[model samples]
Each structure stands twice: as structure tokens, then as C-alpha cells.
Target: MKDFLTLRLYARVARLGSISAAARECGLSQSQASRIVADLEDGLGARLLSRTTRAVVPTEAGAEFLARAEAILDAIEDARNVVREGEDLQGLVRISMPSTMGYLEVIPRLTGFTELHPALRLQILLEDQRQDLVRDAVDVAIRLGTLSDASATAQKITTIPRVILASRRYLDKAGEPITPADLTHHRIIGGPSGVAAWAFEREGEKVAVDLQPHISVNDNEGAVVAAIAGMGICSTPCRRPRPEMLDGSLVPLLTDWARPPVEVHAYFPLGRQTRIAARSLVAYLKAGFGEPV
Candidate 1:
């Protein structure tokens, strides 16, 4: 009989589209994972994955096998749950979210969660870049912007308002702009898109401004630091840096002119059977974070 563990590993590799990522998830070395997959292909006499420098994609046979593999894993979990029904919630629940949000929002409240489920293990991965739910083995994810993946199920956590901000020193130095048009003249600290266009609305009227910032940073924290250092003004989600605002390190700008709110969502992998522990945690986050949908 084929080893069920090896089959589970193969399913994870196909889902994540990276041997290294799957290796990390399965607690195996990258070389070992690669060799195992190669052995499976040889045994079946079919190529399972097309590997490139950037990513690994499943072949037709591999894709077909993946669906069945997932089903088998799900069935196995269901069986295990039936056996462990009387015990406390115990197992790992991996989560991914934006680094800044994790620090400002989730991390502070993590102890409360751990206290509720002492036997459960929480693995939180903080990253600003997007992550694949299956590939990364993340049971749940907190996303700030639009979700393009149709394969995942999402629940709205709250709507985050996008707002412009500046340090008092920077505002004093450059003078605060009264209108969106005046932002063009000041030094702007920006992100990857780098001084791109921003939209503002008030009283049912919208205006777009093409801003050219003096400094460009690829990280959210970096932009916040730059703005606080009086480098320039910054645009960020309103929920962040509450302490900074309270302590007078950062100040809001253009409050009367409204910007569109960005939706915050909690997404789980599609088709995979979610654990009772994971479902409970998601519910806790929804209630704790903001206004729920």
C-alpha cells in the first residue's frame, strides 16, 4: 500500500505549487520533499509537476490526483475528530496576516485566545506580501484589500478607512494642504506604486490626484517611519498606529475629504474541511476585531 503520509505531502505540494513551501509545512527538508515527489512520479510512470525557477505547477495527472488526495485527507481528519471528541481542542492552527496588522491588532489579543484553548498550538505568520492558503498551510488569513482568488471562502471582518497622515513637524515644515490638489506640492512618502494617484470624495463629489512623492518605500512600516521623521506625508489605513495618534506622533489629514474604505476579510481554504478549533478561532477574531458582517 502507498504511504498515506507521502500522498498527503504530494497533495500539499500540488496545492501550494512549491516544493520548498510544502516541505516547510510537512516538517521535511526541501531535498527530502523533492526526492519523495520524484520517487512517486517514477513509481506511477507519470510526471506530476512542471517545475520552473519561479514556481511549480501540477501536470494534468497530478491535478486529477490532487482532488482525490484532498478528499482522502479530509476523510482522515474527520475520522480522527470522531475519535478525539471527548478531549480538549488540540492541534496546530496556522494563520497568516499583514505584519503591521498582526502587531497592532492580533498579537496583543493572542494571549486571550491561548488561554481559552490551552492545548491548541497557534502558528502565526506575519507578512505584508500575499500568501496562498493551501501552499502556505494557513488555516485562516486576514486580508486588507480585494481578494481575487475564487477558490477561498471569505467573511468580512470590517471596513478599514484609507486616510492620509503627516507628522506635526512635517506639516509645520511644509504647511498642510487644504485640498487634494495641494498634495502635489508637498513631499509625499509612498509605497511600491510610488506616488501614484489617490482618490478623495466629499458631499457626493470625487476628485483624483496624481501625487509625486519625494521618497518611496516598499513597506508599510517604513512609510510610517518616514512620515514620523518628517520625511513627507503618508497614506495608510485608519486603524493602524493608534498609539502614535494618541501620543501625538502622527496626525490625521484631510478628514473632511473622504476616501473609500478598504474591506478587511478572513479567508479560509476552499474544499478543505476546517477543524472545529479553527472555526472557533475565526469566530473569535470576527467578534474581537470590528463590526462583523
Candidate 2:
């Protein structure tokens, strides 16, 4: 157990690239962590890490060892999961997702999950950009669009309905568009990149409208807010604007047209080594989405 804990500490130090931070997570002082690492090097007769005032990074040998150590730790965690299945989950789980999905979908579901595993520690990163999961130490990233050649393993969670929307006031001022082509003359609110083209279909007829946004945001929520303020028409998933549509703050356009659904994917940067807790949360999502849990 002592050796196991020491190995765990070393893995955290390597993963974080900060001895002080790793020590803090493991409930050890900086001096203690430093001494432990030094002792580990002395015992192995190897220079495991290159140390500097700014950062502590693994040497070539340490990098190799870290990969093996992480695999061992993951196996141990898997063993624990086998024994403690459905019990309280311990330790940290880092998750990343778009901000709007976090607020509308994931966060609300978290209460039920955390209540069951009160010992778990969650670090949620809500951003519209894709993160370098290995560098950021993210266990799972729930993405709400096409995978589109991302360098990570992805599981298709479910497809969500999409819509092109605008506020009533905006429509009143700009004059409602009759078809996809009319959008060429209208102000458009776009999200980030790769979404500049919007697709619509009706009665086996399909059209893809290329756009240059009058206003662009990196976040979906921002685009929705822009539309609500009567900035322009925006295309996004239906789940986000459900409440706004009901309350008359936003209106779905092109009722005769059907937009392609947004594909939801749960990305695993560690692939087969993804932590059990992260997988558990994804299973909960599968159940919620009416998929096979």
C-alpha cells in the first residue's frame, strides 16, 4: 500500500507537471513531495524528472515509466470498480463540454449522480473549444456536434433535433425569410467556425446555405442571446431554446423545413483507459437519452 501510494503520487506529479499542485491534491506538503521524488530517483538510480523553478517535467525515462504507471493505476481502479460497482466513487473526475450543454443538460443531471457518489470530486470545464485532453488531464469531453476527424475516441451518445431560430421582433423588422435562399440577404448569427454553412431539407428536397455571420460568437449560448436581442437569425440545437421558444423570446423559423440533427458524442482522450467514474456518468446519460445503458 505504501509503494502504491508513492507510485500514485509520482503519476499525479507527472500528469500535472507541478509537484506542488500534485502534492496538494494528495494531501502532502511541497517539501514532502519533493523529498519523495528525490528518494524515488535515488532508489532507482535514475533522473526521473527535470526540475526547474517554473515547472517539473518528466525525463525520457520518467515518461516511459509514467505511461506504465498510469496503465497500472487504471487497472487497479478497474479492479476496485469490479468490487465496488454501484458504490461511492472516490477521487477526481475532470469533464469538459460546451457551456450551454453544461447549464441546460449535464448540470441538472449531476445532482442525482453526485448524490449517489458523494465521495467523488468533479472538475467541470465548460467551454465551446475543444481541449487537448491529455495536456489538460480531462477524463471525458461531451461534444454536441459531429466528431469530424477529432484525434480522440468517441462514442455516439444520441442525435438531438436542430432548428433555425430568431426572435419575433427580429422577424418583424427584417421580414421573414421564405426559403433557405432568402437567408443569403439576412443577417446571420454564427457559432465559432465549421458551422458557417446551415443545412435544411423538406419533402426530399435539400439545401445547404453558406453564411458570413453579421455577428459571430465562439459559444452557442452567446449566439442564442444575440438572436434574442434581435441581432439575427441563428441555427442551433432545439434543446437549448426550448424554454425561450415556449416563452415567446425565440421563434423557430422554416417550419416546413427539417434541419439535420446535432450528433452528440462522448469523447475519451484516454480511450480504453478512461476512468470508471467518467464511464459511469456517460451510462447515466445513455439512460437519460433513452439509449441502451
Candidate 3:
């Protein structure tokens, strides 16, 4: 069990690139954690970590061992869960997701999951960019849109309705666009897709417009913020901005037209090697979204 604890600390160190951070997380002094890791190296007869002025990183041998160590720890947890079928789940689940989705969907719906699995620890990493899940030690990621990577193991969760939106202040000044083509005359505040190739369909007719962005932002939340401030008309997942839209801070534009829904998927970076706690979290999310278990 002591050796297992040491392995857990090492895994955290590699993931965070800091021995001190791992020590803090595991409730140990920096020197004690350092000594444990050194003893682990002595036992294995290999230098697993390389310490630098800024960060402690895994060596080539350490990277190989880290993967095995994670798998071993997961297996031990799985064994324990099998024996304690009715008990709360254990171990840590590191989840990756976009800022908007995390705030609007996952975070709000997580209380029940946490309560049910009180022993389980959840760490959510939020970003708008595609993250290197394996390198970052992410168990699961909630990815939006059609996944470009075929190598990843992905499960379709749900789709979010896409819509054109703008603040009432801007629409009152620029006038509401009655048609999809009318958007060409308006300033388009870009969302994640920086370029404006807005796609819309209505009654068997589809219009694809390629308009340059008036102003751009990398994140969906940032674009929504810009639109709320009357920067320009923006595109986003309808459910995410529902609060602002309901409060009359923003208005849905061109409601007559239909845009393709954004795909929401559970992306497992580690594929079949993903932890049970991670899968359980994904299941909880699916149920919250009204999907069949």
C-alpha cells in the first residue's frame, strides 16, 4: 500500500510536471515525497524522473513506467469496485472539456454524481483548444462538433442546436435579419471558427455564406460575451446562451432558418484503458442529458 501510494504520487508528479504539486495533493512534505520517489527509483534500478530548474518531468523510461503504473492503479481500483459492488466508487477522474460546455452542462449536473460517489475525486480541465489528452492525463473529454481524429474512442452524447444570436441593442440599431442572406450586410462576430462560413437551411433550401469576421475570438463564451456587449451578431450553441437570451440580454436571429446542430461527444483519450470512474461520470452526464443508460 505504501508502494502504491508512492506510484500514485509519481503519476501526479508526471501529469503536473511538479513534485511539489504532487506532494501537496497527496498531503506529504516535499522532502518526504522526494525521498519516496528516490526509493522507488532505487527499487526499480532506473531513473524515472529528471529534475530541471523549473519542472520535474518523466524520463523516457519513466514515461513507459508511468503508463504501466496508471494501469496497475486502475486495475486495483477496478478489483476493489468489483468486490464492493454496492459501495461508492473510488479513485480520481481527470476530465477535459470546453469552457462553455463545462459551465452550461457538465458542472451544473455534477452534484448528484459526486454525492453518489463521494470517494471519487474529479478534476476538470477546461479549454477551447484541442488538448493532448494522453500527455495531460485526461481520462475523458467532452468534445463539441464532429471529431476530426479517427484514432480516438468516442461516444456520441447529444447535439446542441446552433443558432445566430445578437444583443437587442445591436439588432435594434442594425435591424433583424429576416433571411440568412441578410446576415451578409451585418457585422459577424466570430466564435470558435474564426472564419464566417455560416450554413443555414429552410424548407428544402440551404444557404452557405462566406463572410469575413468583423471581430473574432477563439472561445464560444468569449464570442457570446462580445455579442452581449453589442459587438456584433454571433453564432453559438443555443442551450449555452439560454440564460442571457431568456433575460433579454441577447436575441435569437433568423429563427425561420435552421442550422446544423453541434455534436457533443465523450472522447476517451486513453480509449479502452480509461478508468471506471471516468466512464461512470460519462454515464451520469448521459443520463442528465436524458439519454438511455
Candidate 4:
């Protein structure tokens, strides 16, 4: 088999077009580079280069061999990078999260982390569907609500208080509902799980109401937008509180009757060795969103 060092020196010499120039690029003396090339040619039993006083040029066989040598060196370098990235804290971490969380929470904090770790890279995958960690090869996933699986390890990052909201325009056009009973007559936007019938507690008593929605969406973010566009009232988590609520676009309808808070979590496979890049990213998120428990 051809030696990697010899092949590298041959490629460098071909690129620089001179032994002396290749020597500088390879951090070797000109004589050392020349000898390496000669050794390579001897190993292959072919004259790889034709040298003149002014310049060195590749022979026909040398040109064909140089192409192969360049490819080999490139592959070796790529393999090295993959191994280094896997072993150290300095590589890419693939992470996935819902669109709203990615846009409103994760993306903002990632900017600072990226600046701090120059070699670390983030591959963010945003989707409304719950990601399968092992199947998708994701390093981490941020999810909301109580985790159903007992096997996967999770850290509670934050809690989002649920709120009831409606656009001012919608309320003005269709009239506001004062009580849970009044919601039946008004249009409401529900999410993928449909209009969840929440039981609210007041004065130490629980009251259950089945919600009816005019429009139902697969994602909470979509429901928020629909509610903002004067579609209908929506019961959503505070993490994606209506922008209108902040800027006077939307207003709370029934504050006292809102459901209990929901929790957001960062989940990963149990007992897996957490990569440094993934750990750093999680730490940054916890600092911004509150520490993981």
C-alpha cells in the first residue's frame, strides 16, 4: 500500500508546481519533500515527475496518479475531521424543536453560544411533529407538556402558564364570552389534540367544560396566528403568548378560568454520553429559559 505521507507530499508538489514551494507549504525542507516524492515514485516503480532547472512538471502517469493521490488525501482529512468532531466538544450538534420555540426562544440564545464557540456548529431542525430521537439521529429535542415515555431521560426546563386569548377585532365583531358556558356560542381555534376540554379550579372546586372550535390546526403556533387574525379565541400556552397580547393586538378573555400551567422539557436518550457541544447548548438554553431540573 502507498504511504499517506508520501501521497500527501506528491499532491503538494503537484499543486505548488515546485519542490521548494511544496516544501514551504508542507513545513518541510526542499530536500525532504524531494526525497519523499522520490520514495513514492520508487514504491510505485514509475517516474512520477520530470524536473527541469526552472520548474518541475508531472509526467502523464504522474498526472493520473496525482488525481488519485489528491482524492485519497482529501478522504483522509475528511475522516480526521469526523473523528475529531465526534471525540471533542468542537463539532456539530444536531438539535430539533418546535417552530415556535425555535423562533421565539432557542434561536436567540444560540447566537451568543455560536459566537463564543467558534468551532462548534449547530444543525437546527424545526418541525411541529414530535421527533424520534434515535431514528432521526438528533442530539437533543425540546418538547412541551408532561413526557409520556418513562424510558427516556428528560429535564424540565421551564413552565408555561396556559392562557385564554382572542383578537380584539374578533371580540369586537362577534362579542366576548364572559363565562365558560358562553364559549360554546363563540368561535374558537383548537390545536392538533383538538379543543381540549380543560377542567379549571376556582374556590377549591373543579369545573369541566367541553370547548367547541370553529377552526382546528395541527400546531399551537398556527392556532395563535389564526386567533390573531380574528379567526377565533384560542387556549394556548404562555410560551407562545399572543404577540397581540404584548402589543395590544389580542386581549385575555377569561383570565380566572384559565387552565393550570404546562411544562417544557429538554429530552435525550437515557445513559448516552452527552457531547460537549450538546451540553454547552443545553446549558445556554437553561440559562435563558431557566435552569434544567
Candidate 5:
């Protein structure tokens, strides 16, 4: 039991890249966590982590050990769940999501899920950056677009529709764009680089627009706010600005040139099937997206 706990501590330190942070997560002091890791290394006769003042990185052996450790943890959780088949679910469910989507879409609807499972504790991490399922120790992740990583299993929750939009006042001042090429002359509000490209397809042809944004933001929520304030045109997922569109704060533009819809997926680490709390949350998300749970 001591060795198992030490192994788990080592895995957390390796995943977070910070011993102090891992110690906090494990409810241990920094010195105690260090001692535990040192004991683990001594028992195995191998140095697992290369520790510096600022960061902790896994050695080759540590990386190999981490893979097996994850499997062992999952198996243990599976066995525990099997033993408690009839009981109410009770555990920490750590979920990761894009900040904008999580705030605007999932956070608003979280109450329904929590009300259903009173014993379940939820830890939601809102980050736009890509997170590793194994390293981050995330039970579930709400992801937009395609799932490229082969190490995670993804279930499509919903298809988020794409739309080009502008504030009515902005369109009245700048003139509504009739074609994708006209966007080159318009002031655009967009994300840094990856989310700025606006592509459209109809029939057999495709039109791609490289937007030169007048207002640049790293988050979709910021870009949407800017567009609603009549700053500039924005091409984004419809889910971000649905309220604005409904209230006429923003108007859909260039409907003839349709942007491809993006898929919203619930991601889990590969290997074992998703467990109780995480699975229930995924079901809630699917239902919240207007699909049957």
C-alpha cells in the first residue's frame, strides 16, 4: 500500500511537472512528497525523475513506468467500481474543457447534473490549450472539432454549427459582405492563428479566407464579445454567440457561403472503459447539447 501510494505520487509529479503542485494535490507537504519519491527510487534502484529547481521531468524509465502505472490505477478503479456496483457514485471527477465553451455552454448547465448525483464531486478545469488525458489526470474533456490524438477515445456529443456574424450596427456602417472575398476589406475580430482562418464550402467548390483581424483575442468568448460590441466581423461556432444572434445584437452574414460545422466531443483516456462519474457527466453533456443521453 505504501509503494502504491508512492507510485501514484510519482505519477502526479511527472504529469504536473511540479513537485509542489503534485504534493498539494496529494495532500502532502513538499518535503514529504520528495521523501516519498526518493524512497520509490531507492526501492527500484533507479532514478525516476530529473528534478531541477523549477521543473520535474520524467526519465526514460519513469516514462515507461508511468504508462504501466496508469494501467494499474485504471484496473484498480475498475475493480473498486465492480465491488460497489449498487452504491451511489462518490469520487472526484476532473474534467477539462475549452474556457469559452465551458463557461458559455457547459457551466450554465452543470447544476442539472450535480442535482442528479449529490454524492459526486466535480472539478472542472477550463483551458483553451490542449491537455493530455493521462498526464493531466482528466477523467473527461469537452473538445471542439476533430480528435487527433490516438491515445484518447472520443464520443461525439454534438455538431456545433459554424456561422459568419457581425453586429447589425457594424454591418450598417461597413456594409454587409456578400462574398467570402469581401471579408478581406472588412475589420475582423478573431483568435490568434489557428481559429482565424474562415473556410466555406458549397456543392463542389471551397472558399478560404485568411482574415486580418483588427481585434485579436486568444479566446472565442472574447472575440464574440468584441463582435457584439460592433468592433468587427467574426466567423465562429454558432454556440458562442447564440444569445447575441437571438437578441439581434449580432446578425448572421454570408449565409450563401456556409462554414463547415465542428463536432463537439467528450474525450476519455484510451484502454479502459470510462467509469461511473465521468460517464454520467458525458451523458449529461450529450443531453445538454440536445441529444438523448
Candidate 6:
């Protein structure tokens, strides 16, 4: 019989795109994980992954095999669960979500979840970047904003208003703009798409204003810090507003003219048999966020 442990190691490594990361998750040495993957590749007479200094991407063949491998693994686990504990299931469920949200929201509620499912183990990957649920062996992903991809299933969890904000010190020194058009006159802290063109509604009419920022950043969190430090105005999802919003450090600028709310989603691959632990967690998240359908 094929070694199930070796197959699982291969799956984890492929999902993570790094031997070291898989090793850390599995509690094995990096070299050991590497050897196991190499052995699997040799036994199959196929090269499953293309490796580089920066990333490990699966070959077309590897991607196809990965799907089958996951099914096989799940079936095996199902059999084991049926034989051992009847309907009760127990195993590791790996999940990923945005770093800030996971830290602020999900991590705190995990204690109650663990208490309910004493036999299950949970592994969480906290990052700002989107993770491939199938490729990364991630069962679910919590994200904010619209999901353009039609292949996956996205469940809207909550809608949060988008707010434009700046530090009190910045507003005091630069003088707050009374209108959206005045934003072009001051420095704007921005990320990714940069200071988004202001879009608002007034008197039941749509209005749009272009914003010109002096500085640009690639990450929103960094921009939030810069905004809090009194650098410039920033646009961020209201759910992830800077901590200083509550304190005197940062304050909302265009509250009346705020952009439309953005939706938070819990995304996962459709049609797969979700593990019990993952289902429980998803239910908890849906309840906690109370997102409109």
C-alpha cells in the first residue's frame, strides 16, 4: 500500500508552496519533508512542481493530481472517522484569512470552538494576500470586498462602510478640506489603486471627484500607520479602521460623504465535502459577522 503519511506531506507542501512551511506545520524537519516529496515524485515518474527561489508552482499534471489526491485523502479520513467514532469526526482543519481580521475577530472566538470539539485541531494562516483554497490545502478564506472569480463560492458575511480618515494632527496642521474636490490640494496617503476617486451621492444625484495623492504605498496597513502618524488622509474599509479612530489619534474625515459599504466574504471551493470542523467554524463566523445574504 502507498504510504498515506508521505502522500499527506506531499499535499501539504504543494499547498503551502514551500517545504519549510509544510515542515513547520507537520512538525518535521525541512530536509525530511523535502526527501519525502522527492521520493513521491520519483515513485510517480513525474515532476509535480516547478521550483524557483521565490515560489513553487504546481505543473498542470500536479494540479490535476492534487485534486484527486485531496479526494482520496478525504475519503480515507471519512472511512477512519466512520470506523472509529461513527458520525463524530476529528482531524486538522486548515484555514486562512486576512491578517488584521484574523487577529481582531477570529482568533478570540477560537477558544469556544476548541472547547466544543476537543478532538479536532485547527491551523490558521494569517496573511493579507489571497490563498488558493485547493492548492494551499486551505478549507476556507475570509476576505473583504467583491470576489470577481466565478469558480469559487463566496458567502457574504457582512457589509462595512468605507471611510476616509486622517490623523487629528494632520487635519489641524493641513486644515481639513470642506469638500471632496479640496482633497487634491493636500497630501494623501494611499495604497494599491492609490487614493480612489471619490464617489458619492448628493441630492439623489451621483457625484464623482478625482483625487491626486502626493505619496503612494502598496499595502493598506502601512498607509493606515502613515495616516495615524499625521502624514495624510487615507481610505480604508470601515471594518478595519485604524485603532486610533476610537482614540484621539485619528478621526473620520468625510463621514457624510462616505463611499458605499463593502462586503466581507467567506470563500471556499464549491462542491467539496467540507469537514465537520470547517463547517463548525464557518457557522460560527456566519453567526458572529451576521452578514446579510
Best by TM-score: 3
Clashing residue pairs in candidate 2, if any? none
- For each candidate in the order shown, give its overall lDDT on alpha carbons: 0.80, 0.83, 0.85, 0.74, 0.82, 0.74
- Residue 135 Cα positional deviation in candidate 3, in Å, after optimal superposition: 1.7
Highest lDDT, which number?
3
Candidate 3 per-residue C-alpha lDDT over 76-187 given as tens digits, one digit per residue, 9 for 90 to 100: 8787766656569887788989998888888988988999989888889888898877766788889998877654689898888898889999998999889888888999
Name the regions of candidate 6 deviating beyond 4 angstroms.
16-20, 34-65, 78-89, 192-195, 202-205, 240-243, 270-272, 291-293
Q: What ordering of candidates by TM-score runs from best to worst?
A: 3, 2, 5, 6, 1, 4
Residue-wise lDDT of candidate 6 within 1-293, one digit each (tens)? Answer: 35878778778877888889888888899999888888888989999888999977779988787778878887777665556442345787788877756766678767766776677778898877766677667777877777664546877877767788888999999998877778888888776444367677656767677877766776566777789888899876656545588886888876667576767787776646666566667887778665321
Writing each residue's lDDT as its tens digit, candidate 4 over 1-293 gives: 34877787787677566899778856799888888888888989999899999878889999889877766654564454556553434545778888877877778767767777677667798978886664344668888777675545787777877788888899899998877778888887997556468557666767777876779998878988899899998877776544578898889877777577777888875434445566667877888776222
Better of 1 and 5 by TM-score: 5
Model 1 lowest lDDT segment of ten: 78-87
RMSD of 3: 2.5
RMSD in order of candidates? 4.2, 2.9, 2.5, 13.5, 3.4, 4.1
Residue pair clashes in candidate 4: 244-250
Q: Is candidate 5 or candidate 6 better by TM-score?
A: 5
**TM per prediction:** 0.75, 0.87, 0.91, 0.64, 0.81, 0.80
In model 3, state the lDDT of residue 291. 32
Q: Report the alpha-carbon TM-score of model 2 versus the true structure.
A: 0.87
What TM-score does candidate 3 get on C-alpha atoms? Answer: 0.91
Off by over 4 Å in 2: 23-32, 148-151, 270-272, 291-293
Estimate, for each residue in 1-293, the C-alpha lDDT of model 1 and write its tens digit: 25677887898888787899889988999999999999999999999899999989999998888878877766665565556664556666888988877876777867767887688788899978878787666888888767776868988877777778889888888898999999988998886434388889999999999987788886667788889898999887766545778798788888899987777788888878776666777777777776321
lDDT of 6 at 142: 78
Model 2 clashes, total count? 0
lDDT of 1: 0.80
Candidate 2 residue lDDT tens string, 1-293: 77777888898899888999989978999999989988988999999899898898999999988888877876876777667788988767889999988887778778878998888888899978888887666888999877663557888887878788899989999988999999998999987545778888999999998888889888888888999999999887765447789998888888899998888889888434878888998887867776211
What shift in Å separates residue 195 of candidate 4 from its native position after superposition? 5.4
